[model samples]
Target: MNNKLHGPLFLAILSTLMAFASLSTDIYLPAMPIMANELQGDIELTVTGFLIGFALAQLVWGPISDTLGRRLPLFIGMVMFIIGSVGCALSTDIQQMVFWRVFQAFGACTGPMLARAMIRDSYTRTRAAQMLSTLLFIMAIAPIIGPLAGGQIIRVTSWHAIFWLLVVIGGLMFFSLFALPETLLPENRVKISLANVFRNYSMLLCNREFMRYTLCLTFFYVAAYAFMTGSPFVYISFYGVDPQYYGWLFALNILGVMAMSLVNRRLVLRYPLENLLKVAVTVATIATLTLALVVKLQLGGIVAVVVTIFLFFSMNGVIAATSTTAALDAVPSSLAGSASALIGSLQYGSGIISSLFLALFRDGTPWTMSWIMVIFTLSSITVLLRRGPLPENRSSLN
Candidate 1:
């Protein structure tokens, strides 16, 4: 592998790498209904199992990248990803698919965390934030087209094709890994120590500012996963929308996300990230609360729910980038890999929690999804308002 890649190529590679996580989730969603019907198991658990693997793998990949360097972990992850995808494609039952999805997710989550970690490796705080906004903007293409593509594939073929497509994607990623530079410098490497990983997390926990933003970011992911978990059922089962069109709806929301991200990228040139964050969260909270109410009252029906969902999702464009940059700003650059890992773990951890809530409480209503979004967004807002700005310092790692 090259010790360094040209800048444009690096960004492209990193964005695709990170985007794979969302790709893993969104691409398979359209298959959920048919898969559940065919395999005679809970559709919800299949998604949940994948998410659990995706979320938890950060714990291992992030720290290992810190010790072993970025490229090796990514290569390992890609291999595992292909194996998992193949397993999913060949699955005979929901249980087997769920287990394989976990393996797949274990491989998938590494991309985004490593992408962020690598950004920290190559740039300063503010610049890294800008780069992240750009990366996420490009990354949107995966989720944007994923379900739509999945829907089309399912229409033309079967759900099994989706995993086979994933297998191809993972294979391509594996081969492309050869071109990516090892962004982790030797001086920056942490000694391979379980104790060191444990200690790094403790340090993150103690940082008040980081924790505040961390909570905010995690809640945002919770809201997203909640939406993702419930939407197929709500749209297809409850509203009678065609499964073929689910991707179109999801893509429309992502367009809003892209627009907001572009707006933030331009706005960040003139305004502070904190100021923008406040406005974004405020808008999201209001939109989500209203969504919950509309769901409860059953007032405007599916159209209303869809509009409100879009409003809530649009805010994530700002929330994800700003909140991530804000949280990472508090820690030393040296611990970027570990910090990125911790953030990914917490984000997915929140997703798992949110998904579980949907499984337990949802009764084929969009209300469960709406309420969870409201709860997570409001909680995020409260933290920002109450916690205030944190004092920056080097990590306890040194």
Candidate 2:
């Protein structure tokens, strides 16, 4: 049965699942202003709640998927996503919307966390790395498609339409999983106990190499979250770009990231993935620092800021895809779910930090986001490139 989960079919399942997870955020982003008024909540707070839900959900779901096997947990996830989406549509207040959003995020998170675990289940380290990139490359299309479609959805209907679309997507994924075979074997399964879950996570936390890649991935991820959280207001309010045009600008950065992922898909087999990741981290650091300087100097206006941002985001595909590959590859196969979940939890934890930072320090200028990106990118570089020979984690693919 697992053999059937081998090729394009498997990629499609994971990408579709990931697409929905991504859609849960990307699609809803453009509608934030309308939502602020109708749902009666602060835009930043709503976004923060949803992202926090999205990240925190993985902590529990990952271990559950590990304990129960992928199928039951994933099935439960899809159902919850549907319910959450539906509940969100019916919400009359912002609080209700936030609650439903948290629920939806929990369900939506199953996609990426389990997708990584499933890849580990069936593929070797290098192949798993390549597969993850390919999955992300496919998932990358969602950001382009989501915001564009979301903008159109908003023009035609209300923000509630976004949730309704999510409901339909959730339904399709739930039914689609019928064909997804259980990838985790009985021997690999662990007991579903609280102590066991903590132990599983604590082991990954203790592993220096595993923490290296995971934290690096998480820190680098904060820049992306900050951009998403802050860009709407920056573009719409500060730059005075039309809401419709904002998605295109957003899509431009997303397309750059996608292009890099495609490049990684080609190079991943030929180069040592870790080396590629290091190079990516280095490039991202420089790009971010340059962006920060540009903001500090107040040079080139919004166009310059956007250009630097695109460059900064372009590294996302190369760094993130490669780092995730390295992180999971470094872990023992048995702890893949736990490792993936912790990675996700930290990833979103940084997202929470990014949101709070934006809320606290934003002064109607892009300087704050620029410095924040620089800070996070530097953190990743420091984690991954400390002043010693890097510890050998996985055997070299090249």
Candidate 3:
């Protein structure tokens, strides 16, 4: 292994490319209220559109990245993102903004899927998990800083400036990605055939263990999405907190995730990925259940709810990083990108479904979010633990 090729600098660059999606999503959240007023539409509708666009775009970009090489697709996605940002900045109507948002999200999906594929391209399961955790430690900055930045931007100028900022970030990411070496070697590249693509997907679909592990991560994401979608309402509408304060609350969860990611990076070398996942899922389930109990009992106030959700989300970083490594390792290197695509499609698919459900159940109360989190977390735990324990090294089994 070349030290220069896999050093922290490369990881940091890769993480930034991957975190672009999160930044695009979260950075715009603080502006949602403003966007609604400016566009003369309901705030909830605008937010839901953004979530749907981002989630659905993942399904398209993931397979495209797998079929085409990672680089070209990434470059194209960046260009599209930049265009979308400009369109958003210039939009005067809600319909036009929604269209641009969908366009923007089409480009945002490339980072996470390809970043994971690149890790599988280079490292073994445990090392891949560690590398993912390291990348996440860098990626965590998007959620922590995106809202704060958006708030400041909104305070100084209009929400349009936020879109312009994304335009700059997208352009920078486009050039920076050129420096990343292609990790999917020609010998390991899958043929871009419809038949082969379907065959590969069928094979993955038939694997019970793969589905179980992937769903575990997906369910956790459902909880996360529920929090993202529902929390603003809970904090601002129900509890009467300011939007800036909500950004700080969101940043607290990001901090928890970053802390757990650091812990995962350190422990992955010493422990089996499966054992770590088991522990993480167990902790997350317990935390979610505890939160549900607190909400049910009306224990404290908004503070207790925030603390519990933060703890639940903290375990997600570890579970997601490990499960992704394990799932990608199940396939041959030739199919790494496709495998990553499927994992992402499933994860965000769950997110889309959960977000919609939360929206439907939303009543400007914290209980709705808490109950949904508990249900998904418990279901995930049941599925993951039902198959005995996860294998020590998933790649060896493959």
Which predicted model would earn the best TM-score? 1
lDDT of 2 by residue, 1-398 (tens): 45577657778988887676567888877888778887776767766777788888888888777778888888888898899999988888988888888888888888878888888787777677677778878888888888888888898888888889989888988888988878888888775685677678778888887788888888998987888888888888888887777889999998888889889888878988778888888888898888888778988878887898898888888887777777887777778888888887787667788888998998998877878888999999999886343345455321
* RMSD of each predicted structure: 2.6, 2.3, 2.4
* TM-score versus the correct structure, for each prediction: 0.95, 0.94, 0.93
Tell me the TM-score of model 1: 0.95
**lDDT assessment of candidate 3:** 0.78
Off by over 4 Å in 2: 191-194, 387-398
Q: Comparing 1 and 3 by lDDT, which wins?
A: 1
Question: Candidate 1's C-alpha lDDT?
Answer: 0.84
Output the lDDT of residue 70, model 1.
Answer: 93
What clash count does candidate 1 reach?
Answer: 0
* TM-score of candidate 3 on Cα atoms, chains taken together: 0.93
Cα-based lDDT at residue 50, candidate 2: 73
**Candidate 3 lDDT, 176-243, residue by residue in tens:** 88787777665556666745565677788787877778888888888877777677778767788777
Q: Which model is ahead, 1 or 2, in terms of lDDT?
A: 1
Between the candidate structures 1 and 2, which one is better when assessed by TM-score? 1
lDDT of 2 at 211: 85
Per-candidate clashes, comma-separated:
0, 0, 0
